[model samples]
Target chain A: MARMLSGRLPDPPAAVRRGPPWAGAFPSTLHDQRVASLLGIALGITFGTCFLTGLVSHFMQHPPNWLSWPSRPVWLYRVTQGLHVTTGLASVPLLLVKLWTVYPRLWERPPVRSVTHALERLTLVPLIAGSIFQLATGIANIAQWYRFHFFFTVTHYWVA
Target chain B: MSGDGDGDTGARADADAPAPAGAGLSVGGFALRVVLVAAGLAALGYGVDGLLTMPRATRPSNAAAWLIGGIVVHDVLLVPATMLAGFTLSRLVRAPYRAVVQGALIVSGAVALMSLPLWRGYGGSVDNPSVNPLPYGRNLAIVLGAVWAGAALLMIGRAVRARRTGPG
Candidate 1:
């Protein structure tokens, strides 16, 4: 009570009362639920696409420098590979946002009951961890620099 | 009296509503979004062009552009746009977010399968290899059919379940 009377509380800034600089950009009517749903969908598609492409590319040979040989044509492998890396890179931001939105659901309830929830939960561990690994490896591959000794190809293949 | 009881409950409920927070779009966020979108578009264009133009003879240029562009587009445009669109659609429809996400993932899978033909060997002879379009086509068909069928089934199940359960 004394603090309030003494004006110790900070005053509201003008920006707060007048509205922010980019106030109207986002639809005013939109709610958090909508945003979360969109994020989930976006992440789902991006991850799925990247995962499938990466898996396919895994079966192909790494070009020019890698030892051994591939049965498929090297050029074809490169293009698909390029696609896989590109899609994965683009998904970074979306993945981050999706994580944010679905965070609430993690605490809200279990995915389902019994085996269904168990299966879904089981996928979550590898899917999340493997996805980060894939993205990191993909970026490293693009930079034309590799440092890991575990053989990224084998790990990537199994994870995907 | 009953009138007094109603008044007390109404006052308590009003107090429970969340106080508005200042999460409306800010200048910095807007600017960031624009930059991201632009960067994505530019990268996509460069990558696609490189893919189309650079020949078997000059391997380095095409490979560089393709790699860089792919990274840019995926990180900036494709992912973000998908997220926003999916979220908005889900909210408007009031559907299960996971199911919607599953639908989107299935579609992306199909697209990836279609582009599989492009993933063959590079840098040797300029000659295009014989691609058996059948496998790719088949894979795409399977992905699409599964996603659509699953989504439809899920929606129907939800409706029936909701009816049986009545309002929560």
Candidate 2:
């Protein structure tokens, strides 16, 4: 009763309520530059593949007067479209992980101290937003979810 | 920090962090910048062209909403979920076998995400026989079963190795 009345009975033991040493540590260390680099390269390759394939699909669907889409490969559209979706799906995991690895920097102090730093940070707006737009639109297009009134092909082609 | 690193040496040690020592321009760096500029211009030009030429029926507002919605969903939901799973796996599994477990999880997760549409019968089309003709659900099950089996074998191998090497 006396102890309770006092502001504090005694100081809590040091480290008494400490969590496990590795409790907060992510299994894949995000700080590792090598891992980030490798993941970035992989993500880049996947995006490149998706972009090129997407362009092919777009051209095939809306051929220019100068270009002709071959009808011999009846399965061409299916194959390219499948590849586009698959690559985009695969990118979901890669992009998530890549973003996770570099997420620490999002909260780094002195957010923008220099001109170069500001420019660099600004670039992320497009890089990230565009990537998200591409993947999201691609997935929705593949699923044929037309919740949006916009034509999928035209918007997707532009967003690509 | 070395000058001899191969393939895009201009890539900073951490993309979001400060550049490492000795970071400077190289052929790879120049190429990368050029490619990025070209791609950016192309995307912007194409997007603008599409918007200008788009049919009157297409709603720009809808497109904008979808674009923003995708970013929100990914950043808000998917990233955290993935981090939680990774943390949980790390806590549950020993270091020796963690890679196998993580690999299995990633593969299964990707396959599962890709298969959801099929599982929901969204891919089926009565009009076009060529599209989505495969038995997706069954195929997904088979692939997942094989993945788990492989993971099990990997675990067994790690266990045997640990026994031989005496646990670390």
Could you say which candidate leads in TM-score? 2
Error of 1 at A69 (Å): 13
- Every candidate's lDDT: 0.45, 0.63
Per residue, candidate 1 scores C-alpha lDDT tens digits across B42-93 of 4334433543454443243433343355445544665466557756765666
Worst 10 residues of 2 chain B by lDDT: B1-10
> Model 2, B15-128: lDDT tens per residue?
533462123546575456545544544555556566667756446677667666766776688767887888888799988798899889888987786556665667435787
lDDT for A35 (candidate 1)? 69
- Listed for each candidate, the true contacts retained, as a fraction, are 0.00, 0.31
The C-alpha stretches of model 2 lying farther than 4 A from their native spots are A1-27, A68-86, B1-42, B45-49, B52-58, B121-138
Tens-digit lDDT track of model 1 for A1-160? 2122222224345544332234543342322556655755565566656655665564444444555455568586677666666767667655555544443333322232233233334434333443444565555544333433334454444334
Which candidate wins on lDDT?
Answer: 2
TM-score of chain A of each: 0.56, 0.74
